[model samples]
Target: MSDVNATSVRAIATKDFRDAVRSWTFWGLSLLFFLLVGLAAFAIGYFGNADTSTADFLGTVSQVTRLVVPLIALLLGWKSIAGERESGSIKVLLSLPHSRIDVVLGKYLGRATVLSLSLLIGFVIGAVVVAVMLSPPAIADYAGFIAMTILYGIAYLGIAIALSSITKSTTIAGAAMFGVFVLFYVVWNLLNFALQILMNQGYFSGVEVTQTMNGNEMQYERLPDWGLFVQTIDPGVAYANALSVIDAVEAPGFGTAFSAELFPSGVPFYLQNWFSFLILLVWIVVPTAIAIARFDRVDL
Candidate 1:
């Protein structure tokens, strides 16, 4: 790109970033994330007890991020583009000589930077709590979690931008973005439930057997194993991958596995997690591409 174009793009991005940061919403959200991190750490460390291992402490931290960070990202990003359009500034901004690609990418980067800072602060607070309670976390673990959070934040930003690009009102865009989160977060569980119910209905069972025991004697039992596949298809499985990365410090205890373990197989090596990660990437890239395309053709 020419220096002039580069300068224009940067100028646009800088103005957006400044406007975003200056808004009360940004600081409020950042403070909320900060408080959440501190509270999550306190809850985990206090309830987890002083004897909780570093691994467990960090695992709790990861859980907090997985469940909480996305909401913060959504709040930060849901209106990035749509808000501009609502205020009638989008046309003026797009009138610049820079391509829509530059505008879209630069806006994404600027908002993402703000989100990264908030997430970083929250994570650091959690880490401090972990260190005070147990051994410090490994640098590798911190690096991996940070990378994952960034990728996830980027994914949310893409979704928000797409929603904004298509809608003319910020209120509508915000609603749509929240709708997306609700669909992803809740619909996945409902799908899993339906799959599990179907599997348990015995449609796949080719044979049925009952086990009876006399004294210490036991008899063999047989049933269809197709239920496992249904479990794998559940979108909640992605959350399991996030958990695995967070829990990488050590495998959960057998006791932990016997009851309510997240990802019993631990990040499913046979392409399930890999597939979900790819889907998430697509979710990020496709909307972003569309937003860029629309911006290019838009009258603004």
Candidate 2:
């Protein structure tokens, strides 16, 4: 691979970003996010009782975005490189003063920027509506949610872009994207159940813990720390955990009997909320790094 030239990378990124903005996909994402936030705001105003706060509203929105943003990112990036190769456009890009590594980096940054901007626009519009309807929202919490949401989208975008790079056929890339969606949303959730099965069959040992409820002692077998760590590594789970830290909003099970018993001596470093941020960073970095290495060696 040719030496990476910062100038070439920037030039390609700028061109790609501008080209993407001109496409309908960019505007569509903005509108979708806007509508999503608008609906959240409407629900909060019409249905929420006196117990609700700005954190509650943002948390509810985060839950929706956690599922939707990945789909948008996958659709946006599924064809970024593979489509170009199939259409003979990749040659034109390569013929310029750019290396394969440069193309990969530039495409990732450009698409990441597009996704981030679309998210920001939607969040801003939603914030405006939310501020007017709700008592002045918590600016810091809202900002953190937006920032985290962008990071979440970028992680998925990296996965999508990497999958796009390894294939010459859009069909394969499309399938890869679908596979990723299922891997995270479906398979990740089943991991805990699978772990339980293993424990039940004596493959993995469960930790014995005791709990007292209503002056009655109960004994139960919980998954080991390593097992719980594995569950939290999922990007969506990490995102939710990270939000609980930043937003100061107790998530559904925060300080609950189950959670307290799960970490009797305090949460492990790997299972803590801060670690989720690192997990997210890894999701963004590792996939792109692998793709860069592979794409550089491939006969594109």
Best by TM-score: 2
lDDT of 1 by residue, 47-132 (tens): 77656665555565556566666676677667777787788877677677766667777787778777777667666765776566
lDDT of 2: 0.85
lDDT of 2 at 143: 86
Q: What does the lDDT read for residue 48 in candidate 1?
A: 73
Local distance difference test, candidate 1:
0.62
Q: What's the CA RMSD of model 2 in angstroms?
A: 1.9
List the candidate 2 regions with Cα displacement exceeding 4 Å. 213-216, 248-260
Q: Evaluate model 2: give its TM-score.
A: 0.94
lDDT of 2 by residue, 1-300 (tens): 568889888888888899989999889899999999989887987887777788878867877888999999999899989999899899999998889999999998898999999999998988887876676678888888899889989999999999999999999999999999999988887887899889988897998888777889899888888998888888888778777778634446421123566567886788777888899999999999988988998886
User: All candidates' lDDT scores?
Assistant: 0.62, 0.85
Q: Candidate 1: misplaced stretches above 4 Å? A: 1-8, 197-236, 242-276, 298-300
